[model samples]
Target: MSSQPVPCKNLHEWLSFLEGLHTSEIDLGLDRVLTVFRDMNIGKIAGCVILVAGTNGKGTTIAAMEALLQSAGKSTGCYLSPHIHFFNERVRIDGRNMSDETWVEAFERVESHRGQVSLTYFEFTTLAALFIIARQMPDFALLEVGLGGRLDAVNIVEPDVSVITSVGLDHQDWLGEDRESIGFEKAGIMRPGGVCVYGEVNPTKSILQQASAQNVDLRVFGRDFGVLDADSEPATETMTDSPVFLAQNSAQQPIPDAPVPVSYQMADGDFVRTVLSEQSIPVSNRLCAIQALALTGVRLDKIDIDHCLSLISVPGRFEVDKNNPKYIYDVAHNVHAAEYLSRLLQATRQRRRGKIVCLFSALKDKDSKGIVSLLDKTVDSWAGWPMQVDRALSLAQLTAVLGDNATNAECLPTLGEAVVRAENIACDRNDTIMVLGSFYAVAEVQSFLTNRANRSRGVDEKGIEV
Candidate 1:
């Protein structure tokens, strides 16, 4: 294959080249990436590295961890996938997206080193992110796994702590059919003799088996550590046999239903209590990130923890627009994430004076029916639009799925039209408009809203006055 001229003009050209470089969108393996990574001699990114893998909550957990570490005066480099707006959002240094020039430089390095080996968009970007982060030599490097843990390109880098946020059946085509099979795929991030934190309440049997076989210092959420309210009993002593105990009682005790100011017990029989202000960010994910980071020898006082956590504002995760007609945006593509969004809606139903109008769409591969059925009761009206992407569901497909559960549905052409239709429906009832489905769905709506807001303020797309 002829090496075409490198797209050194800007980040956009480089990204476009990467999208069409490989035959398939997702080629999940490490051999090709590792070959290029080793050639680049990128070693020991930071003093501590954390690899986060799961069906959901990876982005939010990493965000929380980065914020906490940065709050403690430690420089952090975080690499996340599927940016909502700018490609720069994928690679962040010191909680800020690196400049476009920096990203172009990283991409150039990867292109120069990769001779004939074909790398997918994710693989090439992952390598570039590692290169950029290693050059900065931050105190901590947080890598969010793009796909399944075991064979993902990011897995090529060994992590000090591997965290599995929550395992569910989302990418059945790549990961597996059931939760156990998917759990096994996620468990691939755990290195032997290394520390790992399992954050969800339901610890799958496969995860237990993998942790035991690898002799990993695995920390289960409820068994090894957990959160408790002020009125609850004292922190339970760290269990001796964590995997075995967890296997037997995984479902017995769940995350506390209580509110903030909760005390989180660590694996070493220590407790840290702090009040969390971000209701959108789950308490379990916050505690999981804190516990995982503590194992890396980074500790924060209660006040610092509270301060950092309060500053975390992840986009598209229950992001609210508190204008005249309120709106909530969540990138809940699969059933697992949909469950979380459903619970939040149910809890806040009492405060909503008007109808809950959900503007929703999803990829063709997703379980659109399951998500629609699950959220049917909470959402009084539905507006579906075909997300402008290769894998998105068409208007007919979306309407067909909504037929099963959604009684008041509006099938529209684009996200803007869908939002307008939803607003018209909610205008009479003072309802809230929620944009749900894949990341692409949220991106479209957010871009539209942002541009509209800017136009209303007499500002152009470049942020210049009109």
Candidate 2:
């Protein structure tokens, strides 16, 4: 390692320095990273930590939990991977980005504690986030897994609750080649006597096996507690078509009968209620977070939960920018995420008149073909870009994956140019634009859109109001 002060006298410099170290993109061993943590005495810190891992819905789940906790007046710290717009967005306390001085101090602390053991860029950054969390000593710390759970650096922390939110085929090269293999890796996040929550309705057998072997208290969505309908009202008629039930009994509880056809809003509310109740969480939003927090014995009222859920927001995950074409941005790069996006698009299509234009790109490591094939039928127009990020595929590779599709597929060298082209093509007021594929692609387009919106709002070129 360079052992030098990060450049630019800012948090960005520290991030840049960390990124510059180690040519390897991913080193899945724990010894080197553990040594740095052990040397820094991070394990001795006082805080309730929750580690979230899985192929899809992890970010959304984390955001909901964080928001619920914050609403309850808890001092919260959240660390997310592969930032969307700014590196600072990765490490946040109570929804605010960390300061430059905080980053410098944390980097110095990690460097001082390291004794001969080398750390990868991720390891270094993970340690920094831990250092910040330890210092802040927030009521709770939410750590999003950078990759698979077992050997990931975040595994070092013995969380009170380990949540695996819907496993799928992602990171096949390192985790495994199939769903079972990926489930095993995600199961690594569970600790002895710790509570394990599976957001997926039916997880693979391997995940259950690993949890049983670890003797972790496992909570599966459909089997444990469940959601059911209580009663129907006209006000909630359009919200949900079906009334969901939260069954407390795990054994021999017959599934509830399907409700009369109703509105989409009621159906969604029913689903949310089912999920929250199945997890043994209270009906209120504060309880939504408190359910997860209850594993650690923290209790809060409904008002508190409502407060937290209202304040928390997960960026670039279902974030919509109200431009002329009305861009909907999400960081859905994998197949499961693509499926979710497909559902969202389908729902929007019911009310909207214009075609949905998709701007897509991804790293070479991802299952590009499978993801594209799934999206091919959903999107009306396709714009591809291969920006020079780590392991980003070239335009040729992206075009080859499209393979002469009927959709309007074009290769744009840069994300900025791609967004401009997409906007121009989506000139009609009824059209909607979606930019996705990689977090980097989403971030690049977000910056462009934010600037464009600012310009339209009469903000000066320098990003300041007149």
Candidate 3:
């Protein structure tokens, strides 16, 4: 692939052409992707691949790993799904998005390589991501599973370390309804003798059985490692006003162990030490994600961890826009993620004085009712909109699931209108507005916010009114 950019007459035309490939939105099978991969010779790429699969926390885990590796000064490539703002956000190198010219070249390569086999939208994009990553030849690559790991397109590449962040009731239509069924599908990413890490609070026995059967070197959080708040210490004599904390590892130490006091300046020392000492590879960003990566055997120094954590930024995940009435935008589309949002709202409301106004939209296949039921009581008002996508649930369909309990419910056809209405209803003093449900919703609102910010010129860099 040459650096000379591939000239496209129109970007929309290219996008439309790509979108016209498959009839079904999601067709889970390995045959089509495998054929394309074989033709393109994806297996020849020389680097360690980390395949991350879970109902939720997949993006967070991948982001953490990418940050850690980059901080270690290693060239890293990452491919995540359902881009929040831009299509390029799905693929990144050393934490920066791939150039449009690079994407165009990749698309062209995929088109040529896909001789007789027809690829789905995801399959096409997955190939494009791999093409880009292969060109870079980074030391490490992190691939986030777009769906269940069993037959997802990204699973075409065998990973050295397979990480299942957490499994819950999600993608039930395709995977299964119960935890065991879901766990089995996610466990598909594991290879013989590969390091498998589970971040779930309570992992099912089926997952363990599959790991054992596959002969995977498995590590589970809580059972193998855990994190807790360090005990408070008195003000230091030298610092005059400083609090200290410590991090300990049970595997490295025995019982009746005493916690060490970490300097206030080095608050994340314990996490950094744990990550560096545990992982085989030297990870860079120790502070932001080292704690999470520590469970998988990646380590970093205190300074490196701090730098990585400081540089990390994940859009639409607890992203706050503080205008006169604050707006909290989050991409919590699943039931488990929704529950977490509900807990956040409950906790925030306890300490702050505000009325929570929820603006939600979701795909037809998702557990819309379950998600809404989780936040119904916590929110002061509810507004629903159907996303501008093929699988989006109509407002009427959503209302049916909401039932009689959604007395304050109102329908808005477009996401723009829903956001405006939510903002209008919120008072300047203490009211808060939140946009959740689907990535589509957040993407649309983010575009609106960007445009609004550009036109006003009064908005801050964070896209908030001054």
Candidate 4:
């Protein structure tokens, strides 16, 4: 790094330089990152730290938790990964993305002491976010792991409360080939005597085993806690008008909404009469969020769940671009995420008359077949292009994974080109275009949609999502 580049002066320069620090994009291990943290003298953050890890629902859970905490008057610093639009999206202080100046300063801090330590792109950037958050001194620090928990750089922080959204096969190459193995790695974030919440519909043996081994106070969904799904009217055909997690089952019921007064029931015969404005999120997500908040000693009554949920909308995660010929956006790269996407697609527009076309693409390392098959039953057609990035799967590779379904997939030159084709098809068939697959796919599609919409008005695509 010293031989190749001069000092980085701006956010882009810092990011570019950091990307080249390591030979690989993802090098799993905390020794190098921890060493750098110590060198910078970054002790534990002033606020409470909550570590979130899992295959799916990490973002939603984090958003819910952050909102609940903030609504209860806690200033929060949140760090997430794989930003859809801007790098600043990764780190948020008090529900706002930190400015470019803050990032540049943090990057410099990390760079100064990382002397001989080679950190991966995620590692360096994660450290930078932590530095900024610690300096800002928020009341709460929510860290989302970039990869598996045991080795991810974020795991360096021993969270006071740990949340596992769900265990599934996604990063099979690094995490594991099955749910059991993956659960073990994710369970690494929990410490003895800490309050750990798992949102899995069916808790895996490995997760239970690990929690037991460490003597962590583990709460499992459906066992120790449960979400009393809000009994609300069916979501309108126009998804933009409603906030619903859309049922994942084939029946597409509206999660069998709870009574007029939605309440979350704890295992000990206690219940909190709750209000959630964002009723569209998964019940499991909300349940886990409340449990986490309670575990962290935040008063449930102080949280304006509805107001908080309304304020937090994650982009590239079922992001709605248009209404009529609906354009749904989600970054469902792996099988676990794909399952959630498939259910979301079915549950939302189940009664709508429009056809459903899922626009997709993925990197070479993902489980292309598993991801594709999960939504095949609901998607009317598929359209995508090999990503422009180096790790993108080739058209041939994608076709091979898609198999007989490949006949229905349209291979285009670029995602923007695919966007145009999808719009044309939607116009002809009255279809809803779902932009999904990798984060790159969602970002490109989001960019295309924002650009198209702004052509007449000429404005930068600035989205306020935490």
Per-model lDDT: 0.82, 0.69, 0.69, 0.75
- Expressed as tens digits, the lDDT of each residue in 96-145 for candidate 3 is 99877788778887777777677788899899899899888888888999
Q: Using lDDT as the measure, what is the rank order of every candidate, best first? A: 1, 4, 2, 3
lDDT of 4 by residue, 306-405 (tens): 6667665677777776433488788878876776676777765564667787788888888788778778888777887787789889988766766655
Better of 1 and 2 by lDDT: 1
Model 2 per-residue lDDT tens digits across residues 1-466 = 3244435566666677676676786899788898888878876343678888988766666777777666567788888887776677778898799877887888888877775667888999899989998888988889999999999988888887888876788888899999999998999998876787776556889988988887887866544323333453313212223344333322123322332211111101222221221111112222223345545554433443333444444677667775543888788888777766665675566558778888888889887777777777877888888866768889898888766542567878877778878888888877888888888878777777778778888897577896
Clashing residue pairs for model 4: 229-258, 231-257, 231-258, 243-280, 244-280, 245-280, 277-306
What tens-digit string does per-residue lDDT give for candidate 1 at 271-316? 5545554365776688788889877767665336766787778988
Which is the leading candidate under lDDT? 1
C-alpha-based local distance difference test score of model 2? 0.69
Residue 307 displacement in candidate 1 (angstroms): 3.7
Question: TM-scores of all models?
Answer: 0.91, 0.83, 0.81, 0.87
Model 4 scores a TM of 0.87
- Assess candidate 4 and give its lDDT: 0.75
For model 1, give the 10-residue run with minimal summed lDDT.
Answer: 242-251
